[model samples]
Target: MIRILLFSGLFTVIITAVQLSLNYQKETEELQTISQQLAETNAPSLARALWELNATKANDIGIYLMRIGLFKSITIKNENGDTMVFLGEKDIEAHQTSIKLQFEYSGRTGTVGTFEYQIVTDIVKRKIKDDFIIILISQFIKTFFVSIFILFIIHKLVIRHLNEISNWLNNFKPESSFSPLALEADKGSSNEMVKLKSAISEMGQQVHKHSTGLEKVVAERTAELEKLAYTDSLTGVTNRGAFLQAANEELNRSRRLSYDVGVMMLDLDHFKAINDTYGHDAGDKVLKQVSQAMANCLRKEDTLGRIGGEEFAVITPGADKRGMHKLASRLQQAIAILNFSFLPDNKNITVSIGYTKVSNDEDFKAALKRADEHLYTAKASGRNTFITDKGFLPRIVS
Candidate 1:
């Protein structure tokens, strides 16, 4: 706004300066015309005085011309180059004009002398200076008020609303909900500001919608990654890490409650030979089927996991020595009855089991180690059998 006012003031100054220059030229020309008229008006009387050799009359005429204030000086010279009259100061810079003083005698006219005058410039300069001051003051006042009015109108109609829009954009957030943008000044008006508000509102909605969809996609991907981390890919059962974590939790719960938790380890007898003969794909299929069978035989409180190649573990909460033996026997029977078309008729699936009851306040790793030792013992004694901390069970031939 200040800039607008300055430019308007400068423009007014330039225009006024131009007008003053023209007025100066016009006033100078009018002075010249007045000087010419004075010379012509006094020429005849001056000429009669010079022809009659009357110096007094010419001097009187010159003095009257000087008193008029238009001429800086007046001088009359006779035809023989004699100065008859001189009045006032001679100003070399002033505008000068000369007229021939002619006197008519009978049928002849003769040039008697020269009438000359210099127009005073001081008077012209004074008038122009007065005019310049008046014009400059009036123009400056008019421009100042006009510039202020324009600035006010622009601020009310445009700049204030633009400030609101700027603030809204600065505070916008895609994750949080926000009220729609509106301008109170332009409420129902269908001007450009209203259109801008509508466009920004629409863009904000799209950003929020996309942000929500992105969050959902990220959540689903995270869940999938968690499943992959905790679950065995081939058997669809808890993997070794998940199993150990769950067993540890169970052990802690049993310690608190003063109850027994059965730990069991099972290894498929001669499982690698099946992989060598039928290929890894058949072995994977067997592992999947056997783990599923074991899961089916367990109670709701049991957790089955594939801890190693052809090796599985189970956590059975609230199970005593008798319950441990019973679950081991069930797992053995479930595996022996399974048949695979890809296997030789003479080859039957069998599992050797080792079982133990967790002692009070025993760590899960120690119980798991004890169960693994028992599994090794059962495998050494004979295949297709269950061994407990006490001794091996009677063989159940399949």
Candidate 2:
């Protein structure tokens, strides 16, 4: 806007200068014409006076011509080349015009004298200066007003809408909804501002759409990663770390509630012998089946985990010693009934179980260690049976 005003001012100045120059030239020409007319009209009379050698009359004519404000000075000289009259100060730098004084006396023309005048250029210059000032002032005022009007139109139609767009961008959020960009001055016309608003609106919508899709994709990926982190690949059961974490949480709750919780460790009996005889594929099949059977035997409140190779653990919340014994017995029965088609008629799968009640303020690791000790005792006694701190189960015939 400032640049516009500056250029407008410059243009006005150039126009004013050109106009002033032309006016100066025109005024100078008009002054020259007036000077020539005055010389033509007054020369005959001045000549007669000089021919008569009347210095007083010639001086009077010179004073009158000077008073007319055309000539700065006038001089008349007789045919003998003697100055007869002079009026006003002679200006050497002023424009001078010389006229020959001739008189017709009874059809005979003869030179009487010469009339010379200097045109008053100072007065003409002053007039031109006044015109220049007036022209400059008027031009400046016109340029100023025109520039201001243009600026106002631009602000109303363009600048204000641009400010609105800037403010909108500052506040825009891709996750949230916003009103579409609109320009009040647009009047629904497809001008530049309207096109800009439409383009920005479309871009914002695309960003929002992509943002939403990206968020959904990120959430699904996070769920998959979480599952991979906590689930056992072979048995499809809770992995060791996740199971221990869950057990600790349950233990903390049990301690606060003053309730008894049970921890149990179970191992497949002679698991290496089964793997050696049946290959790891069969061993893995047996493990998966045994884990599923144990999970089915347990209540919903219990958590089952594959804590090691051929080793499983269970956490039972709000359980008593009798509840633990019943759960352990169910687990044993479930494993005993499992049938492997590839196994010989004489071959069978079994698990040894050990159970313990969690003591007050005991963490899962301490309780699990005690349960593991019971499991070792059960395994040492024989296989295919369960043991607790209080007692051991009678051996079941396979």
Candidate 3:
């Protein structure tokens, strides 16, 4: 954008310069014509006045020219190499566009003193500046609309299709076969970016012979998928990889529909301490109990994933700020009072949760980071709590 803006600025400047030069020359020519016409009309009186050395008549002519406001200065000089009368300031502006002309008249049988009138610009520079400004504004308006039009075309011809492909990639499931991706029949633009997207979409959809054993192909495909399925062996919930994939796909969809999503990260407080004191088996039981407790609090559409060890992440689609608070509170309460009487000393576990609402345009990782930040905030303000814009609180609901 910066580069485009700079280029636009330079273009406007260049065009403004050209427009200014054209206007200046045009106005200068017109001014010269007007000056010559004025000098011709005043010729007879001024020549008679200078021949009789009538300062009054000569001064009157000078005053007439001055009153016209075209010339900055006026002076009448005699032909005897002498100054007859100087009536106005002799100083002229630097690089001023002006014209000087001499008017002579034959009085009887002799040449009279000359009338040297100087005409300076009354509108050339101003008109040049005005032309430059008009051209600049015109260029700006054209550039703005053209830029918007180009962006719209790119979005329709390439960006929308590319986003569609990206969403498919995010939702790719090895266990399922997707129909071939094809572009609609529109030959409006043939850009390389669009072509590359078409190439990527065509990768796995190549037509091949189906003459092999049908059952054998199905069996081999299932086996291959079994190896790639994203599932946690221990908790039986989503593993980290599966969580990211599903969440990313959900995010892409939410963005397209302009809806909000929410994510939460929780750390079982003193999880390592539990393992150190009661052993790995007891820690395993705790993880399972907490996982179940969280699951019980969530809707069917919400996702539960064990990030690793005692850290877990959750993604809830279509959850706004109010929903985010209610959901986070329910999970918090569930985990806080979890019953583990079977463990020694009737041990209970508390979780510190960090959460944030996700917008469609944001990355899942960014939402995760915010959730983790709130998680840290919860942990920092004393464990067994959740952080919101309202600060850390133990129970958000009555």
Candidate 4:
């Protein structure tokens, strides 16, 4: 648009200049031809011709020159350089000498023989200057409106839509809700925008899908790590650290509520003999079977874990001395019934169990120490029986 306006303005100026120049050229040519024609006539003809330029005819020609937008001054001077009759005036004062009109005539260069004249004016120059001003003002107004309209259309249709697209792309994030924006109404009316919108929609979907997949992978890995931290690698039962942590929490709860907490410490019967008789693999199987049997017999709230080599602990909250004894007997029975093929010839294995009940005045480690002693007693008495302090509640004689 700007280019077109510039070219149009330049073309207007060039045409105006050409028209003015042609007008000047035509006037110059007319003056030259009139001078040559007068020169072609004889001196007698020249005199007769000069007689025709009388006062009435000169006045008529002056009016004609004014009407035709010609020169402002016309005068004739003889070969002696003396000014004769002026077209628009009678004569110049001696102090105000006029410019001579020197035209060839009668095979001589005398200017109308003391009566020749020429016409000159500043009128045509002023008219051309005025015409140029008018043309420039008119063309400028036209060009201004054309430029504004063209720029307005471009901004509304193209620049605004492109800016929207650029902003959407800049702020988009993979974790955010990335639904593609609805294309502008004007954009939707076009097929190119529709295609662009579809592509952006697909990209958003792919980003959402990839984000979901990444989240799932992270969650699964976290779960696996948690299991490894809490569970025994060989038997899939709670490890020593996990069991102690849980038992401490349960003990704290029982203390707060004035309830009893029971802990059982058990060990496999003749575990070293089994590992020596068969192999470490068979010993591992026996441990797994015993752990599984104890787990099956216990409630979900009860905790069981492998605390050491062939040694295990079980915790029962809200259980008294009698309840702890009964639970120990059940665990012993469960271990006796476990069908383990850990021996050299697929022989069975049993476990000895011992348990302690926490009293109001005793700490958890003290109770655990008592349970360890009881476990030793059970192991010494028989490989498959359980032991507990028979007088734990009856002998509270304080």
TM-score of each: 0.63, 0.67, 0.42, 0.59
- Local accuracy of candidate 4 as per-residue lDDT tens digits, 1-398: 66867887787778767877787667566654544344333233333334454445434443544354333344543445544435554334311223323345566754444433343424445666787788778767886787678777766666665667777778777778766756655642445655676678688779878997888898998988889999999889999889888988888888788888888889888889888987898888888888888899898889988989999999898887666766777787877767654343455667787787877777777888898898899899976877787766432223
Instruction: Write one digit per residue (lDDT tens) for candidate 1, span 216-288.
Output: 8999999888989999999999999999999988888888888778889999999899899889999998999
For every candidate, C-alpha RMSD to the true structure in Å: 6.8, 6.4, 25.4, 8.7
Worst window of 10 by summed lDDT in candidate 1: 389-398
lDDT (Cα atoms) of all candidates against the true structure: 0.85, 0.84, 0.75, 0.69
Name the best candidate (by lDDT).
1
Q: How close is candidate 1 to the true structure, as a TM-score?
A: 0.63
* Number of the top TM-score candidate: 2
Better model by lDDT, 1 or 4? 1
Clashing pairs in 4: 39-105, 39-106, 71-120, 71-121, 72-120, 72-121, 75-117, 76-116, 76-117, 78-114
Clashing pairs in 3: 354-375
Query: How should the candidates be ordered by TM-score, best one leading?
Result: 2, 1, 4, 3
Ranking by lDDT: 1, 2, 3, 4
**Residue 240 of model 4, lDDT score:** 88
Candidate 1 C-alpha error for residue 208, in Å: 1.8
Once superposed on the true structure, which residue ranges of model 1 sit more than 4 Å away at CA? 47-56, 73-118, 121-125, 183-190, 222-398
Candidate 4 segments whose C-alpha is farther than 4 A from its true place? 1-195, 342-347, 393-398
Root mean square deviation (Cα) for candidate 2: 6.4
